[model samples]
Target: MIEQVTVTPIAPPPAVPRASTWAAELRATFTLAWPLVIAQLAQNALTTTDVIMTGWLGPEFLAAGTLASTFLMPFLVGGMGIVGAVAPLVAQARGARDIKAVRRVVRQGMWASIVIAALLVPILWQIKPIFAALGQNPDTTLMAEQYIQIGVWMLFPALAIIALRSLLSAFDSTRIILLITIGGVLFNALVNYALIFGNFGFPRLELRGSAVATVLTNLLMFGLMLTYVLRHRRFKRFNIMIRFWKPDWPRFREIFRIGTPIGLTVLSEVGLFTAAALLMGLLGTDEIAAHAVALQCASMAFMVPLGLGTAATVRVGVAYGRKDAEGVRKAGWTAFALGTGFMTLTCILFLTAGPLIVSWFLDPRSPANANALGLAATFLVVAGFFQIVDGAQVVAAHALRGLSDTKVPMIMAIIGYWFIGLPIAYVLGLVLDWRGVGIWLGLAAGLGIVAVVLVARFAMRKRLGLMAGLG
Candidate 1:
């Protein structure tokens, strides 16, 4: 009775909004995306450097690197796709302020990446025999085998790095990834010098040396990223490091639920391209060589929008977390606009300076260069048309990912690539004898169709309130 007059303290209210949600979404999207874009650019530069250095060895070495990369690519690219499953999931968890779910996702993603690397390494290791069975030249096969074997070892580290990057991206800390990628590229260049040419008192290993350099650099990157994440104050708060060491079955299952379809979707697209290369090889070495050059160039261009797409996912995820459907729509459209603008500019550059660009990797003055350059130029021109559409599609896909609708996009990709795209490419490239250009045209068709369908699906979902809680 005597203490009845005691007063209870009231808690302060949450901070009021400072800006329009659309404005906030735009700022956050760029803040998250620019670093990722820079990181992607650096990674591409690393591969470009490898190609440039190998170009010095002669066409056979360059061709071997290209072939080996294409064959080994599904492991790395496809694995990254699987890891990509983590981002949207983490993003949504972050939005919900569910610290537990976030930590669980990080751990499960690490495990999934390990499994992916394990399954892929053996398949890549035995690729030499497969190439031989496919009638690849003995010289190309020998060089490719050496490169593939060493490169395959790097898959473990690459997968780890990819897993780390995806988690970081979800947290909107892309600067860390950018910094590490820049370091990796520089390290790769130095290692390549020492290993490829026997510098620094090391034995010259040539092509195999290049592979060794790549493996060492990737391992270094993974170590550095892991160390940084563990020590960083920001990341430590989320227990990303701790949870990564402990297995969480429920979280792992959630990751698989979201990730498997994405992995298969990516696998299907990459498989189609790989199949195209194999079929092109059947046509002749020159065709294969030309295809390799064009493919490399296109891959480089594709990374720009790919980075944008990553940013789009983060933006959409953040918006979804805020439970703002309108914000999500605005962010998605803004990303599409930015991506399309960048890719359209790229198209103009490719049209005007394609020959110059191809010459950087392939010497037109060389006797074997004429055909390759000529065909590459043609492919680049055709590639120009699709780049914008490709960017749009990727951004749209990311929007869907933010909505946690991975299954739908996966289905669309499967239909777009296999049911629609690959058949068209085969008919044109092989049956009608349109060659590499034909294959590219088919790719354009598939990507365009995907762009339309995915964007429409996202629109429908938003309009129908299907994305209410997913915000």
Candidate 2:
């Protein structure tokens, strides 16, 4: 079926000035970067809120929540990955001055996302059997089912918001996304507090309460975003409402093609960590705890580069749309430098403040905790060391994604993490008995290899758009 998009009466965006110099590229990239960073941080804050509040309900709740999350996590990310194709597609279209293409991409993205969300419901709702099949404790599985039953309601709205965010990012409209996310952070907190504690005479729901808050917040955020996009004067021209329910098989196909790999790439990275955590467990609880502390620290620090990667995606996508290779290179390098430079500073801080950072996560007063703290501090030093390479790889991978080169990059990540990184980690950490340090060293090596692979792929000018027709 042909994708049908009605043209809105709104005017197209003014052309972004050609980025000719490093400074110019930096300025342009950052103009979009800061908001994205804040948005990402705020988004992370939402997850942190859920984790923290649910923890207060006690370990059972925590475990249940964790299981529920683990079950839902891949779906959330994969949907985003699929929907993420919207940004580059929209960005490129905008660059090529094909406003109709922009509208079709967004519409199809929305259509595809809704379809995915609906399909997920029956599966998510009936996952207790799945948990049982996996040999989970029956009680924990039941608790997880209760939480997910409520939380499942949020998927459609969340996916819709993700799709909208992608569309707006391509159009250089991130501030609103940031604002809404900031508002969501506040709203989620308030709702979580009220429902979790039964504040202001509200019945205390505890675990169920957190899911309730998530459901409510997602609904509100999606509504706010959708309302704004439909009514915004500048965005109204995309004719988002025009042919809103129309089916566009070709465009949806492209979304899946571009997005499936993107989603799997992300899932692979998450799996990498899961593998890392499993390896840490082999060294004993202290080692595992210390590894967790180190990973938490590294994850927090990673937000900066992750944001820069998003900016890089937008910039590179736009450049490709304009057929400006020089612009692409400049944007890619500027993002690389900004991301790496900032991470380098963080690495210094991690190394110097290792003890202090460990203290923040682990209790230093207890004798038993001392071993964990020291191990964590050591891990932090390694974490610091890898931050630079991590930043480089994420930014480069995102840049390649902007050019619609995802399949090879996806394979590279799998090979880098699973094939190269995991075995080396097994040898160095297990066989060599290097413990946590050895595992981290392997992770660092893996990231460096993947970074090299992605960077090399980005250099091949011909591959950048050779498959645009495929997308």
C-alpha lDDT of residue 98 in model 2: 77
RMSD of each: 6.2, 4.0
Compared with the true structure, all predictions reach lDDT values of 0.78, 0.80
Residues 190-250, candidate 2, lDDT per residue (tens digit)? 9999998999789988878899999988898899999889899878888877978888778
lDDT of 1 by residue, 1-471 (tens): 000111232231222122266667667667778888888889987888788788777767877887788798766877887778778776666655566666667778888888888988888988778999988787888889889878888888887787788778877678889999999999999989888889999999989999998999899999999988888976776566663467677767766777777777777778778877777776666667677766777778778778888888776776676576776787788788878889999889888888888788777888877887787788888888888888888888888787777887889899998899889998998899898888888888888888899888877985655575443
In angstroms, the error of model 1 at 236 is 1.8
Worst 10 residues of 1 by lDDT: 1-10
**CA shift at 469, candidate 1, in angstroms?**
3.9
Task: Flag clash pairs in model 1.
Answer: 320-471, 321-471
Q: Which number leads on TM-score?
A: 1
Q: How many residue pairs clash in each candidate?
A: 2, 0
